[model samples]
Target: MEATEIIIKCILIVVIFAISLVVAMYSTYAERKIAAFFQDRVGPNRAGPFGMLQPLADGAKMFLKEEIIPANASGLLFIVGPSLAILTACIASAVIPWGQQLTIGSTVIDLQVTDINVGILYIFGVVSLGVYGIMIGGWASNNKYSLLGAIRAASQNISYEISMGLSIIALLLVTGTLSLREIAEQQHGFHWNVFYQPLGFLIFLVCAFAETNRTPFDLPECETELVGGYHTEYSSMKLGFYLFAEYINMFISSAVMATLYFGGYNFPFMDDLGLSQNWITIIGVVVLFAKIFAFIFFFMWIRWTIPRFRYDQLMNMGWKVLIPLAIANIVISGVVNNFLNNA
Candidate 1:
C-alpha cells in the first residue's frame, strides 16, 4: 500500500480503538448516574464535579489495585481470558460504518476500517468467540462457583445466538445483502428496514440483551447466585477488562442496531439541508453516534429497571419464546417475499 493509505488506515484504527476505550469508560459513570436517578438517590458526586470524572477515577483505581490470581488457577488462561474478551470486543467495530465516505481533495476516505461482504456473519462469529473468554476464565479459576457461571454463560450465549442468527436471517431476506454498509445505504432516509421487519427487530433486540448478558438476562453473573460470576477470582485491571468489554460490546451492538434498523447514519430530510458532501458525511456520522448513544442509555436503563430472570426462565424464554418467534418471522418473511415476487 502507498504510505498515505497506510497512514490513514493506521490513524483510523487508532482513533476507533481510543474511541471504544473512552466510551466504555464513560458508560460506567452513565450507568451509575442513571441507576441513581431511577432509585431516587444521588449518584457519584466526588472525584470531580457531578461525578463527571468518576470513570477516570475508576480506571485509576483498577490500575492501582493489586492484581491477584488464585493459587490453583491456570495463570496463563486466566490472563488470556480477559485479554481475549477486550480484544474481540474492540475488533467488532471494524466492519461498522460510522458514516458514508468523505471526499477531501483528490482522495476519498471511507469511514469504516474494512467493508467485508459477510460482515454480519463476521460479527456473529466474533460474538460467539466472546463466550470462550468467559468460559476459559471461569474454568481456569478452579472455583466451583466460577465453573457454574461459565456453564451458565456458555449455555446462555449459545441459546441466544441461535435466535439472534435466525432474526438476522429474516432481515437478510428483506435486505438481500450481508454487508452492513450496503444495508445502511439501502435504508436511505426514513425508509428503514424496521418498518418492514418490526418482528425481526424485536427478536434481534431481545437476543442482543441476552447475547451481551445484560440484565433481566444476566444469569451468568447474577450476584445473588454466582457471587461475582465468571470473574469471581479476578482482580485489578484484569477484572476491569472483562467489565469494560461489556460496555464496548454495548456500544457496538447499539451501532449495529442503528445501522440495521434505524438507518445508520441516514436520516429523513437530510437531503433538504443542501449541505456539501463533506459536511453531510460529518453530520451523518454525528447522527449515527447519537443513535448509538441513545441505545447505550437504553441498555443501562433496562439494567436498572428490570430484575434478573431465573435460570429456567431465561432458558425457556430463549428456547420456547424467542426461537419460535424468530422462526415464525422467517416463515412470514419468506411468504411475503414469495408474494412480492409473484406480484
Candidate 2:
C-alpha cells in the first residue's frame, strides 16, 4: 500500500475506535434518561446541561473509586478478563462498512477501516471470544456466585450463538456474499434483505439480545440471584471496563443489525437525489448512524419494558424455539432461491 493509503487507514481506525467509545459512554446516559422517562422521574440533570456530562462524571468516579482484587482471586487473569472483553468489543467494528467511499480532492477513502470478505464470520468469532472474558473473570474471582454467573454466561452464549449463526446462514443464502460491504452495496435504495428474510432478521434480533445479555436474557448477571453476576467481586475501573464492554457490545450489535437487515447506509431514493458522490457518502453515513441509534433505543426500550427471563426459560427459548425457527427459515430461504433461479 502507498504511504498515503496506510496513513488514511490508521486515521480511519482511530476515528472509528473513538466513535465506538463515545457512543458506548453516552449510551449509559441515554439508558438512564430513557429509563427515567419510562418510570416518570427526573434523570441525571446535575452534571451538565440536561446531564450531558453525566457519563464523564461517571467515568471520573469509576477512576477515583478504590481498586480491589480479592485476596483469593487470580490477580492477573482477573484484570485480563475485562481488558479482553473491551478489546473484543472494540475490534469487531473493524470489518463493518461504515459508509460508501469519500472523495477528498483526488484521494478516495473507504469509511470502513477494513473490509474483510468474511466480515460476518469475523464478527461472530470476536463475539464468541467475549464470553471467555466473562468466564475467566468469574472463575478468577474465586466466588461461587461469580463462577455460577460465568457458567451461565458461557452456556447462554453457546445456546444462542447456534441460532444466531443459523439465522445468518439464511441471510447469506439471500445475500450470496459474506462481505459486509458487498452486502450493503447489494441493498442499494432500500432493497433490504429484511424484506425477503424477515424471519431470519427476527431470529437474528432476538439472538442479538441473548448474545449481548440484555434484559429477558440477562440471566448471567441476575442481581437478585448472582449478586452482580460475574463482576460481583470486581471494583473500581475494573468494574467499569466490564460495564463499558456491555454497552460497546450493545452499540456494535445495533450497528450490525442495522447493516445486515435494515440497510447499512442505503436509503430510498438515495440515487434519485442527483447528489454528488461525496454528498451521498455523507448522507449515507448519517442514515446508517440514525438506524443504529434507532436499534439502540429499541434495545433500551425492551430492557425497561420486559422482565428478565428465568434461566430455564432462557435456555428453552434458545434451544427449542429460536433454533428450530432458524432452521425452518433456512429451508424456506433455500427453497425460495431455488424456485427463483429455476424460474
Candidate 3:
C-alpha cells in the first residue's frame, strides 16, 4: 500500500510539473496572439498553422541564443538567480488541488501533489521566497540598472504582500480553516467564497497582479527605464528561465485564484448531473481548468489594456488603499461570521 501510494504521488508530481511547463510555454504564444488581436495585427501565422508552434520556435531560439556572462558579474549567483526564480515558480503548484480524487474500481487517486494542513501558509512562504531570485539576479549583475530593478522588485513585493496577507486573513475568517482542500470542499455546489468575499477577492486579485509583477505593477522590469529590468545582463537559457518563470508564476497564480475564491473544482448543479464518480471527477478537473484559463486570459487582457503604474502610484495604492480595505474586510468578515454563528 505504501509503495502504491508513493508511486501515485510520483506520477501526480510529474504530471503536474509537465502541465505547468506546457502551460507556461503556451502562455507566451497566447500572450502574443492575444496582443496581436487587440492591436488589429496578424499574429505569428508563419511559424505553423495559426502559429500553434510559435512557443516551440521561441524555445528553440532561446536555447540557440549565445550565452553571455557579464565580465564583472558574479557568475555563480547570476546563474542561480534565474534558476531559483524558475524553481520557486514551479514548486508553488504542489499544494493546489486540481480536482477531487479519481476512483477506478477499488483504487483511489488524489489529484493534488500533497494536502498539507498549512497549505495557504506554504504558498505564502514560496511566494515570499520568489523575490530573492529577482533580487539576487539583479545584485549579481553588477550593473546600476539591474540593481535598481532588483530594489524595485523587493519593495514592490513587500508593499503588496502586506495587503495580500491581510486579504487572506479576511478569507481565513470566512473559511475557518487553513487547509486549501477544506476550503474547496466547503464551496461545493456553487457556494464559492467569492460570493461572500468579493472585497477580499478584489484585494487579493490586485495583490496577485502586484506579486506576479504583471503590467500596471511591472515597475521592476519596465524596459524603458531599466533596459530589461533585472534580466538585462542575462542571456541564452539563463534569460529563458527568468521569462519562463514569469509565465509559470502567472499560470500558478491563476490556478491559485481559481482554487481559492472561484471554488477550485466545484461547480453549480454538479450533484444534479448524477454522473458517476470518475465522470464527475473528470468533469470537475475540466471545470477547474476552464476557470484557470479564464483568469489567465484576464491577466493577459489587463496587460494590454492598462499602462504600467508609476512606482509611487503603485506603492500608494498598496499602502494606502488596498491595505485599509483588506483590514476592513477582515473586520467585516469577523462580525458576519460571529453573527451567523450566534444566529
Candidate 4:
C-alpha cells in the first residue's frame, strides 16, 4: 500500500474503534430504556436529555467506585480476565465488511479494515478466545459462584459454536467464499442470503445470541443463582470492563449478522440513483447501522420478553436441535448446488 493508503487505513481503523466504543456505551443506556419500557417505568431521564448522557454518568460512577481484589485471588489473572474479554470483543470487528469501497482522486479505499480470505474462520477463532476471559477471571477469583459461572460460559460457548459453524457452512456453500467482503458484494441490492437460507439464518441467529451471552441463552451470569456470575468479585473498572465488553460483543455480533445474512450496507435500487462513489459508500454505511440498530432493538426486546433458559435446556437446544438442523441444511444446500452445477 502507498503511504497515503496506509495512513487512510489506520485512520479508518481508529475511527471504527472510536465508533464501536461509543456505540457500546450507548447500548447500555438503550438496554436500560428498553428494559424500563417493558417493565412499565421511566428509565434514566435524570442523567441528560431523555437519558442521553446516562452512559457518561454510569462510566463516571464506575470510575469513582472502589477498586477491590479478593483476599485470596490470583491478582494477575484476575486483572487479565476482563482485559482479555474487552480486547477480544473490540478486535473481532476487524474482519467485518462495513460497507462498499470509496474512491478518492485515483485512490481506492475499502470500507473494511482488512479482507482476509478466511474471515469467517478468523471470527470463530476470536469468539472462542472470548471464553478465556470468563474462565480466567472466574478461576482467579477463588469463589465458587464465579468458578461455576466461568464453567457455564466455557461449556455454553463450546456447544453453541459447533452449531454456529455448521449454520454458516450453508452460507459458504451458497456464496462460495469465506471472505466477508466477497459475501457482502454477492449480496448487493437486497440479494441477501436470508431469503435463500432461512433455516440457516434462524440457527445462526440463535447461536449468535448464545455466543454473546444474551437473554434466554444467558446461563453464565444468572443473577439469582450465580450472584452476578463470573465477574461477581470484580469491582470498579474491572467489573466495568466485563460489562462493557458484553455490549461491545453485542454490537459486533449485530454487525456480523448484518453482513453475513442481511446484506451489509445494501439497499434496493442503490445503483439506480447514480450517486457518487463516496456518497454511495456513505449511504451504505448508514444503512448497515440501521440494520444493526434494528437487530440491537430486537435483542433488547427479546431479553425482556423471555426468561433465562435452564442449563440442560440450553445444552439440549444447541446439540440436539440447532446442530442437527444446521447439518441437515448443509446437506440440502450441497445437494441443490451440485444439481444446479450439473444442470
* Candidate closest to the true structure, highest lDDT: 2
Better of 3 and 4 by TM-score: 3
> Which portions of model 1 miss their true places by more than 4 Å?
none
Candidate 4 yields a Cα-based lDDT of 0.93
TM-score of each: 0.98, 0.99, 0.99, 0.98
The TM-score, computed over Cα atoms with residue i paired to residue i, of candidate 4 is: 0.98
Query: What do the candidate models score in CA lDDT, each in turn?
Result: 0.92, 0.95, 0.94, 0.93
Candidates 1 and 4, the one with greater lDDT: 4
Give the Cα-based TM-score of candidate 3 against the true structure.
Answer: 0.99
How far in Å is the alpha carbon of 94 misplaced in model 1? 0.4
List, residue by residue over 1-343, the lDDT tens digit for candidate 1: 3888888888999998899889899999999999999999899999789999999999989999998999999989999989988988988999999999888788899999999999989999999998988999999999988899899999999999999999999999999999998999999888999999999999999989988889988887889998999999999999999999999999989989999999999989888998998898999999999999999999999999889998999999999999999999999999999899899
Q: What TM-score, to 2 decimals, does candidate 1 have?
A: 0.98
How many clashing pairs in candidate 3? 0
Worst 10 residues of 4 by lDDT: 99-108
